[model samples]
Structures are given as C-alpha cells and as structure tokens.
Target chain A: MSKQYLTTHTVDEAHPTEIFSVSPTPSSLFSASGSSALQIHSTTKGGFPLQQTITNAHRLGCHHVCTSRGGVGNVAASVGFGGEIKIWARQGSELLPQHEANGEWELRWEIAPTQTNGGDVWAVALSADESYLACTTSDGRIHVWDLTARERIQSYETGGSGTGGSFAMAVDLSRDGKLTATGHESGAVYVFNNNSGRLAYSLSGLAKSVRAVAFSPGCKRLAAAGDAGVIAIYDMERGEHVSNLSATSSRPAWITSLDWNDTGEYLLSGALDGKVKVWDVARGVCVATHSETEGALWSVRWLPKNERALEPGMGKGEMFCAAGANKSLTFYREATGI
Target chain B: MVRFPGQTVQETRKFEALFCILELAHEALLSGNLITLRNIYYQNMELFVSQAVVNVMIDSLASTLGVGRWDLNIGILLPSINSIEKIDFHSVKWVLVIEKEATFRTLAASQYHQTSKAGHGILITDANRLPLSQGARARLNSGSQRDRPTKRSRTDRGGDPVASITNKPFLQKAENRGVTSLQQSISTEYPEANHLGHEQRLEEELVHGVNENAISHHGAGDPVNSTMTLTQTDRKKVVSILNEICTGEGTVCTAVSMEQKQELQRMLVLNIKAEIQAVDHFGDITKWLDEKLCKW
Candidate 1:
C-alpha cells in the first residue's frame, strides 16, 4: 500500500532564487538558496516563522547545507558555489558569525589556496559529532578535515591527477563515522574506511553521472542515484551491487538528491523531473510520490521525529521538506488513518 | 559416456545441461517470449553451476546460429546491427535509426506516428560498434528495386484499364502505406510519452480542479458560514488574524497576495465544513490553511 503526505506549510517566496538545500537541526530548519544569505525557521513554533537570516553567508551563492545529526544539534555546515565552506553554531536562538572560534567552541581550518580553485567544493557532510567535515572537490578528491584539530587529516583520491580524475559531485559521512562515500560524475561510487584512511570499495554499476550518495543510518547499505534514473543500492559489508530501485514501466528522471529517514526504513529522493518519492526499502517499491512544481528539485530532507511522535497510535508519522527552482519550502506530513 | 574431444564426465554433463537449456531458450524465442541468460541459469541452477557457464553457452549458441546473441532476441538486448546495411531495410518514406533500445521502445509506444500518418521505418543499431563500410553507405544512399514505382493491374479498378496498367508510381505508393502500418505497429508496442503525459495531466487536473471547485463553492455560499463566502470586511479580519498568529510567533509570514488570501479563506471553510462535529481551534485552522496554500 502507498503512503500519503499533506503539505503542512509553504513559504512560497522563501528565497528570491532557487532553494538548493534544506537542513534540519533539533529546533530549527536552515534553508540555503541561490541568494547569499541562509534563512533559518523555527520548527518548534506554530507557524515555523523565520528566526534569523545570516546575510552574506556565501558571496556568490550557497548550493549545499548540512546539519550535524549527533552532538548538540547546533552545528551546521554550508558550501557555496564560490568554493568556500562555512560552519555555523547556534547560540541561544541566535546564529553567530561564520568560523568565529570562541574558547574551543569552533575549529578553524585553512585549506591550501592552490589546491582548490573556484567551484571546486561541490558538496559537504559533517560527522555525527561535528568533529570531522568531509567535502568533495571537482577533481574527484574527498578531503576529510579534522574539525577539532583544524587541519586536513585525510585525502582520498578516486584516480590519479590529469585525465583520470573524475569530478566528485556528492559526499556523505556515515552516522557511525567509520565510512565516507562519494559519488562522482563518472558514475563511480567510492567508499573509504576512516580507520585505515584508504579506499575500501570502488563500486561499479551505474554508467551515468551520479548526483547523490547517501549511507543508511545503520551504515549497512549505501544508495546512489543520478543521470541513470535508477537508485543503485550496494551492500557495504560485501561491497556488492545488491539491487536497483526503479520504476517498472517508465524510468524516472535524473535524481538530484537523496536522504534516508532516521529509522532507515524509508528513503527520500528528489529528481530533476520535480518529483519527490518516498521509497520503502524493505519492499523495494516507491510508496509515495509528490510533485508540486515542474521545475527541478534540488534537495529533500526528512525532519527528525521528536519524542512525542514515538508514542504508539500516532502511526509513526513521517514528515519531509523539499525545495528547488520553485523558490518555496514545502513540508509534507504523513496522512493518518487513510 | 561418449567422449567428444578432450572432455571428462563432468565436462560432458555440463555440456549436456547447457544444450538442454539452449533448447528451452530456443522454444521460448519461437513462442515470442524473450528469456535472459541469467533467467536460464537461475531456472536450472543445479545443472548450470554458475552464471558464467550459462553466459558461455549463450555465446556458443549465438556463434552456431551465425547471428549475434542480441539478434536471437533472447533477452532485453542492446541493438547490435552496427551498420545501416546490416538492417533489413525496406522502402519507406522516412527512416529512424535509434541508437538506444529504450528510446526506440518509447517512440514505438507513442501515438505520434499514427496521428501524423507518416510512413516511417525504425532501425536499431549499437552505437559502440564500427561505422558503416563504403559499400554499405553507397547502398543506403542509392535507391533499390523496392524504391522503384510499378504498374498496377488493369482489372482491379474496372474504370481505366490502360491508365491503371501504365501507372508507374503504384508500387511506391503501396510501399508507403505498408511503411505507415509498420510504423503504427511499432509505436503501439512501445509508446514513449503516453505514460508520463498521462501522469502530468492527472496531476494538473487534480490541483487546478480542486482549487477551482473550492473557489466556486465559496462564491455561492453565505459569507460567514462558508469560508470562501468572505466579504471584504471578513477577508480583512481573517488576514489580520492570520498575520497576528503567524508574525507574532516568530514565523516569517510574508504579505500574501490577494489571490493567496482568498485561497486560504476557501481552505479554512472547506476544512471547517469537512469536520463539522469537532471544535475548531486557531492552530488547527492555520495549519490546514497552510496545507491548502502549499497544495497549489
């Protein structure tokens, strides 16, 4: 049986241009768009009102933003199209300036200027504790920065320099902080072992550009999708191409973003065709599909389920948010008793 | 066991099993059902031992048949007709050379050719293969015997015996009709855009029809009871209430346009009407209103 989601709230004019990424903290939701500023909305209140707007967060425009799932849930990371990465921490309902280290509260890392030209940093992800940050470079390099030490600790290269290097488009740090995976333009998904600081698996299957790579919450499986219009799931332990999730009759459009819910039972995917689909992992079928606009969707995220929702008879309701060229933030709540 | 060249009992058993599997595949193809090498192996798992063994048998079968494995139509194969001459071309008005099987299937399933009444032919080729040779290129460019016009039989029309017999373009015209029918069949089998187009149409209909229905229903009802039946004063009151509830709570509520305000009011009334037994609260009303606005 399929699931249903009703749009709970929509900030139609949330951003002047396209909204690329939306990240949820414990109490707030952060949305980064083509504009230089990052907008924060309070999820605890009735209206989800805009709490703060950090102007000039990215001079050119911010494309990706992520919040740490572990730790204090106050730390967030954002990367802009101008090749700059900034970390922000929430302080009593107010977000402070970027990279302002106050008594070991923040770590400052200076990357070598020559290594990254403009537009090199495409995607970024933070470790569970916010102690490490993983970012993908245009030349297929995954750089792991030790946030506490404020230094570059490990660099995993997909290929040698020159013609062999493929552009790394997406990166994700596993919840356990043991594995780091990256999706590249060459349709290669590479998983690295953090403990050994070496490449663990160079997965092959999809022959099209990979736009999104995500590790399941349990870190047992990894999902990758892109121009191939199919989601490829790999068994992390055996590093084998396990199965594919795709429509039976007609294939979906290019998948741009992917996110797994906290329980890891459902996977949320957004595509260039403007459809956001909720995939039931165990059944290997798409349970719900929602398309509100014709414009391509750049990001989708599931809001963390609070303790109140854990109680029985609530139907284990799930909520997710999607944003893209429509310039609106749409929230979908799972329909109950349907 | 009768030994055939350097073979052991195990090797002979493997070969016999492969032969049996190949016979089953041949039967399936003849009945117009395609089977894959993997499917064949899985069906006879105990006999085949591994997928690699089945793959080798398939290649051997293809070589024995003097055709490519894909040409046998035993699976969802990529088109392997490398050169245009390799395609058994018939005289048609238009030729469509598709590099991908998926695309060809999509186009074939669409009603595009049938509606347009275009005489066309579709040829699938593997783009990774070598290009057409000079001789094959010349044949493709030059017209063949099938392209030539032919005279029609005199007794068929019964009106102009001499004219019908002298008609030079009869065969070419007949070929055109044949091509049209062929194209129609191909498209019917594969329709490319119908699935997506139907989905998009349904979605648009739901979104637009629901909003319109809510608005029209609001216009005909009492201003107070039906939320859509709001007067100018009522609209102002609702907007003010929304603003107060939204802005005061630290939520960023932008100044909604006139159309959006009406939509919110219509949704409020619909929700209220839908759940008439329950006591309505400002929070519930606002939440439902937000959901309605986002639905558009």
Candidate 2:
C-alpha cells in the first residue's frame, strides 16, 4: 500500500548557495551548502526554526555535512570544497538550552590538506557510536578513522587493488557498525565485512553512477540510487540485490540522496529533478513521491523516531527533510489516520 | 592491484575519464546544469586526450544501458561529416608523408597537425581506421545503408547474472532492454583487472556468509572528536612507515581533487594492533604485514 507525506515546514533560502547535504540528529537537522557556514535547525512540530549557524565553519564553502544518526546528537562531520574535513562535537550543559533543541556542536578535529595535510576525502559517514568516521574518496576507496585515536583505523579499497577501483561515490555504515556499504561511480555496490576486514559481498544490478547509498535501521536492507534514477534495494544479510524502486516518472532523474525510516519499512529517495519518493520495501513500489519544487535535490534524510513523539495527534510515523538547488530545507511527515 | 599514476596508461585513462564523467554528471544533476559532450571533451581535453576518445567513452556507457544519450544528458559532438563530395587535389597546398610510426607518435604528441607552420592544413593519420575508409566509402556510394551501430562481438548479450537473481519490476517498462549490456564496457575495459567486471559478480554469488569475527566490537558512545594527532609515546614523537604509505599512496591514486576516496583499513588496523601486541618479536610483524599487503 502506498503511504503519504504532507509538507509540514520549509526554511526557504536557508543558505546563500545550493545546499549539498542535510543530516538530521534526534532533535535537530544540520545543513551544509556552498556557503562557508553550516546551519542547524530545530525539528519541532510546527515551525522548523533555524537553531544555530556555524559561520566560517568551512572557509571555501562546505559541500557535505552529516550528523550521527544513532547517537544522542553530539557528533557531526563536514567536508568542504577545499578538500578539508572537520569533526564537530556538541558542547555546553546537559540540560536542553532554551533557544536550541540541539546543543551547539564545536569543531574538534580538523583534517585540512592545506593545514595539517589531509588526504582527498569526499562523502563522510559516522558510525552508530560516531567513534569511527568512514569516508569515500575520488578513487573508489573507503577509509575508516577512529575519532578518538585520531588515526585512520581501517581503509577498504573497493577498487579491489591497493587503491585502483571506481570512484566510491556514496557510503553508509550499517547501524550495527559491522558492515560498510559503498556505492561506486561504476554503479557497483560493495558491502564490506568490518569485522573480517575483507570484502564481504559485491552486490550487482545497478549499472550507473550511484550518488547515494543507505542502510536501513535494522541493517537488513540497503537502498542505493544515483544517475540511473532507480532505487536498488539489496538483501543486506545475503548480500543479494533483491529489487529496484523506480518512480512513476517516465524519464527518471538521477537520485542524489537516500535515507531509511526508523523501522526500515519505507525507503526515502531524492532525485535530481527535486522529486522525493517514499518506497514501500515489501511491495517494491513508490508509495509516496513529492515534486513540490522544480529544482533538483542533493540530500534527503529522516529525523530520528523520537522527533515524531513531539506532537500527540501526529502519531509516531516518519519525518524526512530534503534540500538541493532550491536552497531550502523542506520537511515532510507521513500522514497518520489517527 | 594498487594502480598508481602511470602504472598502465590505458586503464588509468579509462578510470580518469569515467571519474570525470560521473563528477560532471554529478555536478550537473545537483544544480540542474546542462553540459554537452563537446564541452566536456574540450574542457577536459588535458584529461581525456581527444574528442574521439570522449565520444567512444560516452557511447560505451550510453549504448550499453540502452538509454538515450540525452538520458545521461550527454550530447553528441556533431561528427562534422560535411565531406566535400569531390576535393580539388590540384589546389592542395602541400602533402607531408611520414612513413615511420615512431615519428608519427612524437609529432602527434606535439599536436603537429595544428601547430605546423603550414596554413589550411588537414592531417589524416591511420586513414584505414577512419570512418570514411574504402569499405565505408563503397557502402556510402551505393546508398544502401545509412549510419547504424555496429555489433561488437567481444561484448555479447550474455546471460545477465544480475537478472538471473532478482526480479526487478521497477524498470519493467524497459523490458530488460540492455540488462546484460550495462556490465559490458565499464567493467571489462580494465585489461589488467583479472576479475573486475563480470567474473566478480559470479564469485560474490558463491560467497554468501560474512566474517562474523569482524563483528566483535559493539561500542556505542556519544559521537565525539579530539585534537590528538597520530599516536604519541608521551610527547616523544613517533611515526610509522604505515602512516607514510597510507597518505602518500592515497594522494597518488586519487590525484589532487576535492573528491575524497576512503580506504577502510580494518585489515591494516587488525595487523597493526596485532603487531603492537607482539612488539617483543619485531620481525614477525613485518612478515605479517607484508603478507597482508601482498594479498590486498
């Protein structure tokens, strides 16, 4: 059965340039754009107020920013166009501040190639604990760094050699942190066994540049999407590509972002044409799709389950936000009959 | 398999071209920017080498998927086949004949065709391989056949490994148009890659289980970061050969791009920790690391 989502709130013109990525924590959403500053907004029931803005966070403008999905909203990672990565940690008192839903997260670790000599790191993801940061590079390599040790712990060369694979485009660590799945420019998706430190399975099917890859909350299913514009879902445990989710659009737009709901039931995907879709995993069909804006979308993410419990009538369903060329963070909520 | 810069020119060029294509497509898709193949070739001429090379690359990707080039948003470079039905050979300014292949290579590298002191000059190298060769001219004169994509046998419509496993109704409208073709060019182009494209998929199918031991750690904490650099022994600075290799080799393979590729080093992490534990026996660690690096 198809589901539905209503546009709840939108913070228009959130950034001066197009926002590249949007990551949501428990109580807040973090957005990074061409602008040097990173904006934090509260995911409250009514108005998704802009919470905190970190100015000069990325000197040459940020392209990717992600927060810990499974953590208590304490850690975050941002990658700037200048080939720099900075890890941010929330500070201040334990009590919730009056003006902010998510406390201020300060910059802690800076890996700037121009400064301390950082390598070329693109898309970054934080493990469940946010202790290990997994990043993808131009050359199809996935590196895992221990934030505490401040040393790179594990590096997975998806290229099958030392470092000669297709460009690893998108990456997502399973919530259990046992698996690291990367989607490459060649449209190949690989699932690495974090424990064995060996390639576990190289899932096939999608034969195009994969812009986004996501692991379900249960880590049982994985959904990947990109230039092909179709969402390919894989059986995570078996490492088999099980199905694909293509929107009703005749000419599918390149999908840029993907996120899973709390239950891993509905998969959310945002495409280049500014269409956001909610797919029913069991049915392998797009249950809900949003084409509210004509502009393209770069990032889409779901708020934690706790965010839904804010309103009584809303019921605990699902809430997701998408951003791209529109320069806005648009929030959508799954409609509940209650 | 650790292919550094200049290891194998062909494979590296293919990778370089594919990466540039995807990156351009990525940027264009995100901001709704429109770019053409001509623009891509000229803009990245230094990277792609030539326009014909770019056209071949795009054709391989687009035709294999059975999608319109426009779907990938790559436009044609306009073959510019305005062939003068008859050229006045008598009016030709000059004709330079180069017999040796070595001489041609050196001249081509210097772009002798355009840089030569002669004016209104057109250079044709390896004319037999050109589109208007003797066989093509005969067919064109007869007017029996127009332009059509030739079937290359190297990449046949073999049994689709992926199609065999899953039932994808998502693109059912496609009717499995080029399901087998998608795995043709991208994966098979790497000559040195013993098992990159098709064979790897079948291997993955045979291997089902994961490394359960790799799932030992179950630590979940507040996502935090520190200013600590590499491990230090109480202010006495220490650096390992592994650190240099990681950063140095990473820079070479990845080039100097804002796009960052990561190498998840759990394998290196395990070996390093094991070596640290057995520091009493130093030789054992080197041998062990050598074995691991070789396997990779």
Candidate 3:
C-alpha cells in the first residue's frame, strides 16, 4: 500500500533533442526522438540502451506517443507535427507498423487535421482495452477513433481558441473508456461523458494556461496545471476544483506534462525548466525533484506495474520512467524498505 | 521535502541566505522604517542573492508602488567579477558583461558613458571602490520607461536643473530609521517617531555635505573606471543581473572549457569584491566565498 522511488540510472545519450515522449512495453521502452524518428530502448533487465531507431517515422519531429496494455490488444499511437497519426505494435525493441491487411508493419493511413481547422495533433491516449484512440489537436479539439472498425467515432470541442502557438496540452481516456479528459491553453479542463456523448464538466482553478491533465485511475478525478505553477485537481462528477497543489516556485515555467501512477496514489510532472517532480497526492507535497539538464522537460510517465512479476502472495511491483529536455530516458525502480 | 539535485555548494548557500533575507526583510519592512529598509536591502545583496532576491524585491516593491514590475524592463552591466560569468538577467531587458576580464581594456575604450546618459544601466563588479554614505539616491523622475513624457520646463537661467518631484515620504522615513538604527543601538524603550526623526536630522546634516560624485573616487589602479556614473536604468539592470545569478540562470550554460572556467573564477572574485566594496555591509563577500566556494 506504500511506494517510494528514486532515479537509479539515466539513459544519457538515447536522444538528440529532449526526449518529449516515453511509452514502456514489457520488454522495451519506446521514445519519440527530438528529431524525426521513433526510438526503442531495451529495458528487459540489467541496464537498458538504445536498441532501435525507426528513421523517418514522421517527416517532422514527433510530439505525442501512447500505448495500450490490454483489452482491444497491445497497440501504440504516435502523432507528429505534420498532422499525421501513426500506430505501431511492439516488436522487441522496434515497433512494427500495424496495417489492416498486408502486415502489422505497414502504415495505417495518416489523417490530416489541417482541413478541419489547420491545427496539428498534440496528444494521443489509448483506452484500457486498446479499442479506442483519443487525440487532441493544436486548436483545442478532441477526436476519437474506434480501432476495431478503424474509423473516426466521435469529436468534441474544447470551447476555447488554442492559438498560443501550443497545441491542446493533454487529453486522457478513462480506464473503462467511459470518460475523456482534455486540458487547454486557456486554463480550462473539460471532461466528456463518452457514454452520454456530451460535455460532462468544465472545471476551473488555474488562471494561466493548462499544459497537462490526467484522469485518476478510478475516473472520478482530474489533475490540470501549466503556467500557473499550481496543479488543480477537480472532481469529475461534481465539476469542482477539489484541491490545489501549490507550486514551490513562482517562475512562469509551465508544467509541460503530467501522469498519474498505476495506483493513482502519486502524480508525476515535467516542467519547462528541465525539472520533474513526483507529487504525493494524499499529502499534497512534492516528494522528489529530478533535474539532470537545463533544457525543458516535455513528458514523464509511470511504467505499468506487473502483478505476476512479484513473489507468490506478494503485491505488484511499482516502477516509473522519465524522459525529457536532455534527450534521454531514465528508469527508476520503487525503493524497497530495507 | 523536494530536493533540488546537484545544487552547487555556492548555490545552496546563496539560496539559504536569500531565503533568510527575504523572510527577514518582509517582516522588517512591515515595522515601517522605509528608507532604512531600502538601504538594508541594497547592502545585503550577494552575487546569487542579487539575482534571486532583487527581482522578487522589485516585484514586491512594484506592487507597493502600484506598478507592474514585469513591465519595467531594465538594463545591467556584469563585468566578469572573479570567476562568475554572466550576471543572471532573468526578467530584464538587456545585460552587458564581459565573461572574461581580458576584455576590460576594450570596454574602457568605447564611448559607453554617453549611451547610458539617462542612467539606464547598473554596473555589477567585484572591485573595491568609494564609501557607501557618499552614494547618490538622485532618481531621474522622467527617465524610466514607465515615466510620463512631459514638455521640458525651462530652468531659472540657461541649463535645465533636474527638479525633484514628489518627496517619497515612505523612503524618507525608512532612511531616517536606518540612520538611527546604525548610529545608536536599539534602546530598551521603544523610540517614538519624533526621537527617530531627531536622530535622522543630526545624521542627515553630516551626510548631506558629502557629494554623490565623491563615491566614484578610486584609490589606485582601478581597471574599470570608477568615475562611470550610472542612471536609475543602470541600477535596475544591476538588479536584473543579480536576479538571474540567484535563480541558477547564470549557471545554465556555464559548462565551458576548464581554462575559461579558471579565468572566470578569478575575475568573479576580483569584480565581485570591487562591486560589494562599493556598497556597505555587503562587503562581507569573504564569508560567502570562503565558507561556500572554498568548501566546494
């Protein structure tokens, strides 16, 4: 019921620019390189290093990347600046393209969002069962696609002009695929009730931009933050700011990215100043701060805990990974009580 | 407790000192000796503290002054005092500093004094200079970017004598309190405003005779000219540079070659000492350098 983590090792030379995105599979960790490519680093055991680099994954640099663990099947989705969304499958260290017919290594058609409002895709979140892929655009629009039918299923508007030169900062789908959460530049956090096909709630707390948002594992809570230097937590059902996580500094450093742990007990945040903080949700305090470089950190995530890997009758193991401004991916194992 | 990893020893000490000063100054300023409060502020600035605390103070003061601090874009000069490089200029408009002391000769040659005519920059150095009592507080009313543009009012005869605007009652009170605090120890009985005023009047008569230009006097071999007068813009610039240094902005890109690093270190000590000596109690840079940097 208790967990603590410290960065044990750092993969220093894995990326050229800051590692903006990170997704971990059972055998390897996938990262979107600063340049135009997707790289996979083997994290099977021991120490992990760059094992594969899929060059030309996109013409321009890739920004958002996501993966599903179970349900619909194990599938990965990545979005780049050129308005194309590409999906791939875990193939050891390299991602094999998932196609409808010929092979799972073929391109699955790139959707051009520029036609709708001339905005770029910023984030992608997969449903727990891998049946749905939800993405946010640069102009505060959320589009969902059903992976089973390979067709666009739903579209939701964030009700704000996202013209601050940044995309919709983040979007997340609930574990059961019943709710979709989105954060916008105007400091508005909107949640859509997927089953009802309507905007469920518009939450408020932050006055500056909202660069990151995440839904709690139970799907009842939402965390949002950005330039305000405070993380605002809202209740999904009530649509109210439940709690505010006060930041330590007053710099206009944006909270560029955020993620909730598998147990939803802690949250991870990356900032514009190349610093990452792990927050203890219950205590409302930053438990740890990581800063290896001076560049901006774009994203961070907790590795999915595997129950089977623990001893018989023991609990599941907790592990987390961080990637950002220094073009590197760092894996940290939860500290065990000695 | 959030731990900032790999914080340099010097940085940690400066941050600690800065936090202490900010917390203490906030409480002291509330007691209402405005002039003394401001002097206590300037005399306590360190390289790093300057960057971190100065801007915060500027912001706090701006709020008190009913001005938006961020909009006050100021210019600064940082001459590679000791081993320090660029003075942190986090939220400022411009910063001019030699990262290496070897450029000092070249800096002296340029018509630098003319460009900074309206007092647009503050110089930060480690070199020793004149006494603080002689330093001027002659703020140019029409100088700052936020100042209103008014028609030039003719003087009594020929040249326009810069007229004093509104008397800053708050600053005057603070200054009076500061002089009293320094000249006389805190008495057991709480000194009334009148008693403080009487003490201040006595000190002012003595201090008034000292011209602002007297503080610019250099004893001997001062590489950077001490006679270079600064405008309020220049002072704001110095504050910005200090803010940057305090916030770790100065160290962001400091992983230079080892050779350059050594030169930077020496220049910082020299320049910083020179600058601090120009102020008053802030001359205790020895404590920061000896206790912090030497340990590292």
Candidate 4:
C-alpha cells in the first residue's frame, strides 16, 4: 500500500499577504514574507515556533530566498523587490552580522552588499557548493557573482530590457557549469556555455512565457515548462524537442518550477493551480500525483540525496519539500521501498 | 553433527540448516509473529548471530529466497539553483520540485516509516541547500568584481567530489508552482558563455515543441511575427516623436490625429518587430504582436 503523511506547522502570522520564499535548515525552516521581513520556524510538529526574526529585512517585500548548496548549516541568500540580493550565514541559527567574516562560519555566512541600486532582481540561483551566486534582473540580464571574491564575473543578457520586457525570469546552471539555461518572458529559452562563454542555443517552443527550465543531472537533456502546461523535453546535444509531457488533468496553467531527479528518469513540475505532477521521462508517463494543499506553491524542491554509506536503519534519498501560501513547509518521503 | 528436522549425519547439513532457519525467520517476519523464532533464538543463543550480522544474513537469505531485486525509481520535484551551481551533466537523470519543507523532511525520514519489505535507498535534502559543482563555482567566483570577471578552469569545479554528487537530480512535487520571475536577457557588462550548438539544441528541444500539433496551432496558423520591416531612420523618428509627446505634463497633446495615430501605429509595429528580432528568448511572439501593436 502507498502511504503519504501530511504534516503542518502553524507559523507566526509573519507574512500578511503571502509567504513568497522558504529555505530549510537542519532543524528549522526559514521563510521570507511580503511584509519585507525574514522569519525562521521549526520543522518539527507543534514546533512552528518562530526561532529568529529579521525585521525590516528589505524596505520592500523580499521576493526570493535560498540557502547554500552546502546545507542549512551554511549561508542563505534572499532577493527583494528593491532589486537587491543579500546573503545570510548562520551563526548557530542566530544570523551572523553581514560584516562579521569569521572563517569557519564564513563559508556558511550570508552576505548582502552594503550598498546596491535595488535593480529589481527577479530570480536568484546558487551553485551546489555555495561558491557562486547568480541573479536575474528586470533588465533582462543574468549576473553571476563569486561569493568568495565579492565581485561580478560574468553577465549574460537575455537581449532585452525593462520590467517584464525581456527579463530572464528563470535560470539554471548545470552541475559542471558547462551550460547555463535561462527561461524568458518572451517564451524563449536560451542555453549558454558557461565554459565556452558564448551563446549556444536559442530554444523556441513555448507559445507562452517559459517559467521554469531545468537541466538533467547528466546535463544531456534540458526540461522546460510554463504557461503551456506541458513539460518540454529537449536533447541538449541536438537542440531539438525530444518530447512533450502532460497528464490527463494537465491544463495550460503556468508552471512555476522544474526539477530533475537524481537519476534523470523523471521530471517534476509545480503549476499555478496548486497541483504537482511527476513525469517519467523514459516511459513518458505520469507516475504520481500529489495534492496536499490548495495554496499557491511558491517553491518545490528535492532534498539533497544522502549518499553517505548506508548504515542499517539509516534513511537516505527520495525526500522532497514543498511550501507556499500557507506559510508552512511540508516534507514527503517515498513510501515504496524503491 | 547437529541433528535437526529433515537432516541426518550424511546430509548436507549446512544448506539444509540454513534454509530451515531462514524459512522460519521469513515466515515469522511475514506474519508479524516473530515470537516463535525470538524464543528459539533466545533459548539457543549460539544458533543465531548478533542483530547486525543477522540483518546481513537475512538480506542474503532474502535475496537467495528467489525474491526479485528491489527496483527503486527515485523521483524528485524541484526548482532553481542553476545560477550558483550548474547541475553536473554526469550525475542525476530525474528531478522533482516541492513547495513545502514538511513534505520533503517526512519523505527523507520515511526510511523508518515505510513498511515495505523491499528496501530502497533514496536521499532527500533541501533544494536550496543541495550540492554545488565546480564550473558553477568558477562562474560564481569570476563575478566578484565588475571589471575583472574571474575565470576558472571548468575541470576544477568537476574535481571536487561533492560536485559529482549534486549533479544528480532529486525528485519531489508540490501543489502551487514556485514563484518564478522573468528571464531577462538585458545586460552588456557580462556576456553569456558559449557552448556551441550543444546549448542551442538543448534549448530548442526543451523550448520549441517540434511536434506537428504543437506547431500547427501557433498564432492561428499564420505565424504572426514572421515578417517585419522598419528602417533605422523611421525607428529613430518614431522614438523621438513618442518621447516628445508621451511626457507626463503635456505628452497627451490633442490626442494626435487618427491618420497620424495610424502612422504612429505602423511605426510602432515596425519598431516592436525590430526589438523582438533583436533579442533571443522563449514563448510565441505572435500573441505578443497584437499587444505590442495595440500599445503602439
């Protein structure tokens, strides 16, 4: 029998309008609010207690939040409507002051430029190691920054400008950094060579804006989905459409997020209608459907796989988290042994 | 020689004894009636090994029992980390995204909760806190300064062992889609990397639906943005006129004659087409054509 458990924690009514972004720590979860403040809550049941709160985090509401790829033990980054991106490193769950540069914690510390123009940063993505930070702007450009150097290294424009004009709404860097793919409002998905440093492919398929684009684990295939309500699979080598996937319930609702599994056999997508569907790429079928909430899901993520040598009774792999409108974070594990 | 059921001094005692014990254990485990075996093992402590050794023994026994190997197909639903870490093209094959933390945590911790007899190994971690790659590190590192973009060897990012792990995708799904901002390609300071046709093809396959049906309904089957013509002099004049007339204080002067409005519309459509042509992006521009022309 397939088993699924729904867990809910009542967070401090911190976010008045909506909880836009959330990040998970080992023992806790952090969330950003439309009220421009950042709050942390425990993940354990009856543990939705607000552990830490950063009031007035942004003069404007925070738009995005992300923890380092290293884990919640390290730094966390968030962007605001003010067009600024800030990193927050954990000093024992007490947010370390941005200026404090202690070495051990430095690797895990959060950062934000003391001064920035507030350029309307739309999206932010980090490397798995937490070494680099990339942000998309309303001006249709992607700026990659080195967290260690505190400098901007590469800037790739999506070739347009203005708010919602030709913005790079979504961007993902392949693990090896060989490729960079960005989904644009123009419904154009462009993949760049981070290594070769040139325009590689200008993908044109989605008739509507491409909201989410993800590269396979092997960086061989790219998956993108959006308003069309279909997940478009592409052969990274051929720059051609390999397949299009949609379930029976699939409609043209805007897909907000895309992620590839560890094995690259499945593709997961989150739609505006508060529905999550899993797609089997090899077989091209909907393997599962999960609907735990009706609130708009702002983000969906697979937990990092635990590859540490398995000890008896020790659990690793096949876990994921989803959070949004309700200001609560939910975790799910695979019920089947496989 | 140990004497037991269906065993004799001349019999193959090792195989028979082990098989009998395993069958008993299996029957007990399956029926949730381990008391018999528990009592027997308790009484004859020397007959069985420690639990750890027993687990291994049982694992081998279970495999030997002719049961099929457990096939675990891990799936994850996740989103955005492409900026900081590039997914290693070598590692994972599938992925999922979830909007809640409880969902992911419970799933990860469910190793203990799952009652399935077949054991499957799956890893679950926070999406934002996932592993990073070296190539992503270089790109991230190169941007420390606006003027000097740090350039690192791609191989360097791949050298780290952790980079290899995260290259694999995690699987999960959520109800509401995560907040995705616009994908803007507007900047001159930092140019995009070039991976030749590899990337182009990736995008085309992922973005452009080459399927006939997907292509057939495009822009009412007319390919609206297929043709556009506008000279630079005309574009410049149109911009100048719009800038002069659209000013906040007096921009809406006399509502402009319809003939001039028509002319302005023509100029605006051409300019919009030029702008559209100038950029590389996703989505169908045909739909945007009417909106752009209307705004013109």
TM-score of chain B of each: 0.28, 0.25, 0.20, 0.16
Question: Highest TM-score, which number?
Answer: 2
> Measured by TM-score, how close is model 3 to the native structure?
0.50
In model 1, which runs have C-alpha deviations exceeding 4 angstroms? A92-119, A161-164, A308-316, B1-296
Error of 4 at A316 (Å): 5.6
| Candidate 3 C-alpha lDDT tens digits along B86-124 | 233223211122111222222323323223332222222
Q: Compute DockQ for each candidate against the true complex.
A: 0.01, 0.01, 0.01, 0.01
The candidates score, on chain A by TM-score, as follows 0.90, 0.92, 0.85, 0.79
Q: Candidate 2, after superposition: displacement of residue B177 in Å?
A: 60
lDDT of 1 by residue, A145-248 (tens): 88667777888777775333577878899999999999987889999999999889999988867889999989999999976778999999999999899866
- Expressed as tens digits, the lDDT of each residue in A1-338 for candidate 2 is 76778987788899976788899888888999766699998775557777889998875567689876576677889986556789987775234422223456788898764432223566889988778888887666788889879988788886554636776778899989999999876889999999999999898888767778999888888888876678888898788888888866555776779988877788888875678888888888888889878666878888887734574443466789999867899988878894
Query: Residue by residue across B1-296, what tens digits does model 1's lDDT show?
Result: 22455268787776677677768777886887676665577577888888777777778778877988766656533222232122222433333332233333344455322322343433323222213444333333223222121111111111211111110121232233434333333334334312221212211222223434332332222122312222223323433433333223322222222122222323222221211101124212223222322332
lDDT, each prediction: 0.60, 0.59, 0.51, 0.48
DockQ, 0 to 1 scale, candidate 1: 0.01
Model 3 residue B76 CA deviation (Å) reads 35
Mind listing the fnat for each candidate?
0.00, 0.00, 0.00, 0.00
Give per-residue lDDT, candidate 1, residue A20: 83
Error of 3 at A326 (Å): 0.9
Judge candidate 1 against the unseen true structure and give its global Cα lDDT, from 0 to 1. Answer: 0.60
Model 4, A313: alpha-carbon shift in Å? 12
Candidate 4's displacement at residue B45, Å, is 99
List model 3 lDDT by residue over A42-160, tens digit each.
55455665666777776545767777633222466887645578877533322322321122233454556553354456678888866688888755678898876877889887654
Backbone atom clashes (below 3 Å) for every candidate: 8, 28, 42, 141
Q: Compose the digit string of candidate 4's lDDT tens values, residues B1-296.
A: 23354465435443554555556655555766432222333333454544333334445654665552121111112223343232232222212122123333433344321321222223333233333244322222222211010011111111210011110111110101112121111111112211111211211121122211122222122343422322333333443443322222123222222112222322222122222221123533223222222221
- List candidate 2 stretches off by more than 4 Å: A92-102, A114-119, A307-317, B1-296
